[model samples]
Target: MAATAATLALDVASCLSHRWSWLLFALPLLGVASIGLFRLLKLPLGVQPGSVVEDVRNDDRVPPALAPAALVGTFFTVLGGGSAGATATSLAMASSAASGLGRAFGLAPRGAKAHRLVHRGWTAACGMAAACSALYGAPLAGTLFALELVRFDGAVARRLPILLGASFVAWLVAMPLAGGYALPAAAAPDPSWQVAALCVLVGLACAAAGTVFGWALRALRRAFVRSPAHPALVVAAGGAVVSVLVFAFGWQRFEGSGLTLVYAAFDGTSEPFDFAVKALLTTVTLGFGFKGGEVMPSLCIGALLGASFAALLGVDPSFAAAMGSVAFFAAAARCPLAAVLLAAETFGWAVAPWAALAVFPAYMGSTDVGMFGRGLTGRLSRAKRTARDKRRREKER
Candidate 1:
């Protein structure tokens, strides 16, 4: 139910954004107004998926107003042509709804606080799975995503069946309402040794690009945080810059979620610098306090990057683009399993092996901390600490 409701609301917002898309002249004004609204309501500028996942992992309470605030803020941001995606907003909404339902049903029975926290975490993970399933139209990938988000543990393992069921049910409900997000079908390329070697190179390049993107985003976010200017003024300046980029610099193609650019890449119509330009626009949009998620923009960047590489390597553009899309996202989000599953689901199983070849290298090569606030290095460090603590406790005993 939570997933269905959030999907409906997001679809409506998307439709309204498309309907008013011709009002390009009003973009700056809308951007300013959108930030102003968030400020007035005392809401966070961006309800990032990473933050929400972290909150769930820590068993933090979801404030009652946050879900609705995210939805409204996302609506205004999208309507204003912010270079962002709605996936995080939907995730926030659905997770909050699930939290509320859990509280209502007393799923956290009278027991140790740890038990209640675990139950809360389970519900939140289920909600995340449901939302991802609806948005991506791949239940297994969505389930894996939620599992990855929470850093799969023994407790989560026990709840896997519940999470899987919720994800499929949400997809079923969402299919009739908003339809699955289907990309343009591309022909599978022959998996030759040469293609596999080039795929490794593509993966390395995408990992480098992903690292640069993450660094730039964090730097810009720091600058925004340290700026002494009023929030509205800062946001308005960002809007003006976006306006200049679109109208003056002829970068109108990089606006919104950049899904059009994704399609263009598959059609072999993308420019050489489409990935770089889209990355810059997305960083500025989010760093300047525009509300939305980075998932779609990351996919767009990956598609463009892959398509450009295809031209240089003489490989199939569609296949390369598809590989790039999943590989880059895997590096950026630190979710190789989910990315691999997503590739299999969206492009067919034939592309899965090649995607894995690309994805694992990208995951290993990426130097950035990742958009999710941590990476494999952090996880390893935490595990080491846990082991050390356990050994110390045993010695004391």
Candidate 2:
């Protein structure tokens, strides 16, 4: 059995080594184009209408000209109160572009076999690199995210090489973007064991915040589907509410992706309430019709809340903010592995263990309900069916 397994692994590795897989190259182009297109279309319209373009040019999934929608959505998220980012949409586009490009090639076997082996792999690689580069200011996090989140078969040996190659290529492409990423120039944590412990507590708080965020999105979905409110109006209302809350709390930190606020939270730059309020605003923003990505804003909120908790605990704000960012991401995305990698990549080795440690409770405390639907355990369709069955049984009784 051992020999057979080794042989199989070798076979898989050999197959993966083939350069016949040229689809990976197409991924970055799609990613850059998709994001660009999402921005371009929206710029002229002055409104974000998120939709997939059915038209195509060659193998490209999202043309640069049509990427304005995603950008506009992101703008609303930052300037307004929409609680989303470029990651989700970009992932979707990457997957679509891969599949579309694969179909155009017509070189592989048709049907499910081709789709599974080629298109899926290509798209997965693209998403991996995009997520890694965008989240941690490099391609590593996105690669890990794609491998961990999308690739379920652990024993599949060939996946690693593809992932590494994709990540490297993406990093190379992004190197022009202000030396990869321009992290906020901020003070380092003062030496204190107490600061580390505070990070753990901040992690816990982030877990709680994740739960609240989950519940808020759920509530919004319920109301939106059930209510007579217009979708655009509902989204607009949420934005207005966020504006009002920002004014009331004097927390501009709550606005947009909250990156600036997140940086400030490191040194107690913003009030704790500011973080809490931004969390509320993002949840409400996304709960309505505003479409974007949720990761960045959530990071900002978690950092602020964590810093506040650290202050309350008499620990370092910087440490707390760092922990909060990772913990909340883990809880919200249900991707602890990705979250830790993001933390490590974002802050380097200094905080990797702490980030990993915080992810557990944050996962535990998080209710699993996220923008994707439910918590980590079940699919949305399955959960809905289960709920329906329970209702039926109750009615029969």
Candidate 3:
């Protein structure tokens, strides 16, 4: 409910922001640093804010005040035309709600040993499910998404009902406000072995794109971190670079969430280069410390990529876009099941079987680094460390 309301508020802010272009310059400049102004000293405007990436891997209990701070920050970020989408903000706010509630009521279960899995995990999962359901208008996928994320935690299984109820409630509340997504009539690919095989190839292509996306992100991370300048300075520089890219390359197609362009791809409006431009701008925004999630951007990229090359793959554009949409996210997130189900809910079940083919290859070949850092990369490293620790213990014994 809170997530939905905040999003609506953000929408209004975005609508109002267009009337005053100077806000674009003023907001991003003040962004995180303005938090410093709260104190009398007026320190170098360096009191930074928080986001999903910072809290998801940390304390199970988050401060209550985080919710308001994030909500206001997101509104301004979107208003400023920063290339961020809503996923990160939703997750962060959800974390705050969950953490705050747990701490407020002293709801610790199974002691500190299970802090991450019990008190924090349950709340975060429900919060995210509700937020996602509100954004995507698919209750099943939204619920499944949150459950899938916490599969590693055994405690979540017994509390599944609570998560489901919360998610459904969120969907119901958000439905009227979001109104849902609807694409115009377009050609659909007939079910056939040839088409399925082509989808497999499309998935492979998306995985390749994921690889390049990962590389660019790493390169930029290295460049930005290696620099000695203040983070705010780097972020401002990044904002400037994104603005130049948008104007210089005529990449208005890459603005906002890029969902409009994604919808247009199915109808042959967005061109092939739209994917490249959107990806570049999105990575730039993230690298520079903007607040947003990568899910929408990934979907946009996949849709454009699939539509552009569908004819080359000898398939229908709509079908290709559908395949591209799921496969790209699956590859990037390394969650084939969630990716396939998300498509099933969005595009219908028929695409799932075919999308599975693309999803499998992409999952296997996609970059180890994922959008939210919740992929096999971290799991594998953790597993390896555990094994190495076991060996060391044995040697000591």
* Most TM-score-accurate candidate: 1
lDDT (Cα) of model 2: 0.55
> Candidate 1: how many backbone clashes?
0
By summed lDDT, the worst window of 10 consecutive residues in model 2 runs over 49-58
Clash count list over all predictions? 0, 22, 0
- Residue 308, candidate 1: Cα error in Å is 0.5
Instruction: Supply the global lDDT for candidate 3.
Output: 0.66
Which of the two candidates, 1 or 2, achieves a greater TM-score against the reference? 1
- lDDT for residue 161 in candidate 1, whole number 0-100: 97
Report the C-alpha lDDT of model 1 over 147-193, residue by residue, as the tens digit: 88777745665799999999999888888776445566656687687
lDDT of residue 68 for candidate 2: 34
Deviation in Å, model 3, residue 104 alpha carbon: 2.9
Instruction: Return the top candidate by lDDT.
Output: 1
* Cα deviation of 181, candidate 1, in Å: 2.2
lDDT of 2 by residue, 1-397 (tens): 1111222232232233233233222222322333344344543221221122111111223343333354434443443333344455454444444444445665323443334343334443454355356435656677666544433334222456666676666566555543222444223355567766676677777788788786776677578656685444554565566556655665443444566677788767777687767777667666654555566666777777777877677766777777887788888777777778777777776677777778878877777655444433544557689999999999999
Model 3 agreement with the true structure over 1-397: per-residue lDDT tens digits: 6666666666665566567655556545744542332222332222122224334334345555556655665665666666656655666677668756765666554365445455455666677677767777667777776665554355654677877787788878777776333332334467787787777787888999987876776566666657688766777787777767655765654666666777788877677777888888878876666555567778888888888877776677887887788788877766677787777777777667777887888877787666555565567788899999999999999
Worst 10 residues of 3 by lDDT: 42-51
